[model samples]
Target: MKALLVKDNLPDFNGHAALYQMTPAHEGHEFVVASAANVPFSGPETYLFPADADGEIKSFAELDGSYRGGLSHAEALSNAGYTIG
Candidate 1:
């Protein structure tokens, strides 16, 4: 499995006017503290991807454990027609 860390923030209204039309656009994705010492406003949050994730994944985990972010890399890979168990 792979993971991608996505920083959370308010959408930029000035640069992305079209995005504003899409209300609640920032509702997706989960965020977790990278470390115990890391504050909510500082440090990177871990975003776990499935083993079947496309392109590349930042974290790897067994299928038995709960996933942290979007679809697992493995699941994504399976959806893309790759056989991985």
Candidate 2:
């Protein structure tokens, strides 16, 4: 599974129009979460796009259609302060 890995550059907690629309709504909205295990690296912040699908938990790549651009593994690993090979 993959996500649309990007920086948490959202403006405000209640200010970013796009994120605001992401709030929990009806049956269509689902809540899924992913976590890190101190393997590599990434982020001052990042968010799950589309907030997962109804009863769906996906990996970064799985977040495709729901998200746009993405970062490379090397970049992400480097960003998280890892020594990329």
Candidate 3:
């Protein structure tokens, strides 16, 4: 399964917004997106976004069709402190 990691732009959470990991909803994971660090998918920090009617999730796309920021896998990995080069 593929996933995208990006900053949460919503102002309500401000600096508290965890780096979000977005992926298509599947059997075990029902959320379209959640906090990247929430592996077990629990706790208040584990923010979840509802999936589409078809159960597919697209990164950086919203209801009004506004453009949001996106990061490549390499960039996300680096941002998550998993790599350096």
Candidate 4:
């Protein structure tokens, strides 16, 4: 599923800042934000969360747990000192 990676004000499992994975709300699935980069988390069962396009759409695979909250995924990748695209 395509998801947006957004900065979460709260820290993650590792006690570090993290991002939120948000998707659209549907029948059984209320609009909620999940933990990005596979942090394994969801919401407190809310239905009033924003469902707009807040961040860049990325595949779940790209959120390979490499992000640890300092810089954004794209920014980190770009500043990795390598010529990666």
Computed on alpha carbons, the lDDT of every model, listed in order, comes to 0.25, 0.28, 0.33, 0.30
Best by TM-score: 3
lDDT per residue (tens digit) for residues 1-85 in model 4 = 3234445443322322333342332222222223223233631211112222342223333222233444343343223221211
lDDT (tens digit, per residue) of candidate 1 on 1-85: 2223333222331111110111111123222112111224544222223211121322434222222333243333333233232
lDDT of 3 by residue, 1-85 (tens): 3444444343333123223333332333333333223223332222333344333344433311111243233333333233312
Clashing pairs in 4: none
Task: Please give the clash total of every predicted structure, in order.
Answer: 17, 10, 0, 0
After superposition, the stretches of candidate 1 with alpha carbons farther than 4 Å from their true spots are 1-69
lDDT-better candidate, 2 vs 3: 3
Cα lDDT of model 2 by residue, 1-85, tens digit = 1222233323333212121112232123333222222223532332233344332333433221222133333333333332222
Error of 4 at 17 (Å): 5.5
* Candidate 2 least-lDDT 10 residues: 14-23
The residue pairs that clash in candidate 3, if any, are none
- Using lDDT as the measure, name the better of candidate 2 and candidate 4: 4
Q: Which ranges of candidate 4 are over 4 A from the true structure?
A: 15-17, 26-85
